[model samples]
Target: MQDGTVERMPRQDDAIRNLTMVVYILQIVNLFGVPGAIVGVIINYVKRDEARDTLWDSHFSWQIRTFWWALLGAAISYPLIILFGLGFLTGALVWCWYVYRIVRGFLAFNDGKPLPR
Candidate 1:
């Protein structure tokens, strides 16, 4: 009414968004080997504080949890492979779970939404 200027909403930090994407990409590459996941989680730990109180923080938390839980699942599943080949089933389940987490998190990140805590 008074002025013809439009107000703009604040934008998220590009660096944080880029870092989050890198981790998600790394996690996806994890399907091939452990190194990618390892690097991704390390980045999460190091940059977690920077993301605090922002939407990206939830993503960092999600990724960290995904890594640890998947690791634990593998730890248990691999032993069963030696015991009676049950690990084949358990390992598949863990792999599916891992993929689901990465995909879900990536979708949320792209949508500019935070994961439910």
Candidate 2:
């Protein structure tokens, strides 16, 4: 029987995990047509280097992609809205997709798993 010792996660790991959680929350708060999402993406870009070569890097990429893609989807939806009124449907679909991404990322992050590249 070796001497008892309990290994614990490093402080940086905790900080990265907490930061990811904050980004997810910000994305959710984005539903209110605010700048929260923009702020979150900015954080991801600025701090992503801290996560490089680690599991958290995938999440950083995932969040950034989610933000840009959702923005593109919204941009397209606006034009469609004016042209054919189909944008409402498309917008709703985009919202669903965005929610799905955020939820999926949050779940994976919570489980200490990485998102697909």
Per-residue lDDT for 3-107 in model 2, tens only?
787777578867877888899999999988777999999999989988887788899999999999999999999999999999999999999999999999999
Q: Could you say which candidate leads in lDDT?
A: 1
After superposition, the stretches of candidate 2 with alpha carbons farther than 4 Å from their true spots are 1-10
Estimate, for each residue in 38-58, the C-alpha lDDT of model 1 and write its tens digit. Answer: 999999999888889888999
In angstroms, what RMSD does candidate 2 have relative to the true structure? 3.6
Quality of model 1 by C-alpha lDDT: 0.93
Worst 10 residues of 2 by lDDT: 1-10
Check candidate 2 and list the clashing pairs. Answer: none
lDDT of each: 0.93, 0.91
Residue 75 accuracy (lDDT) in model 1: 98
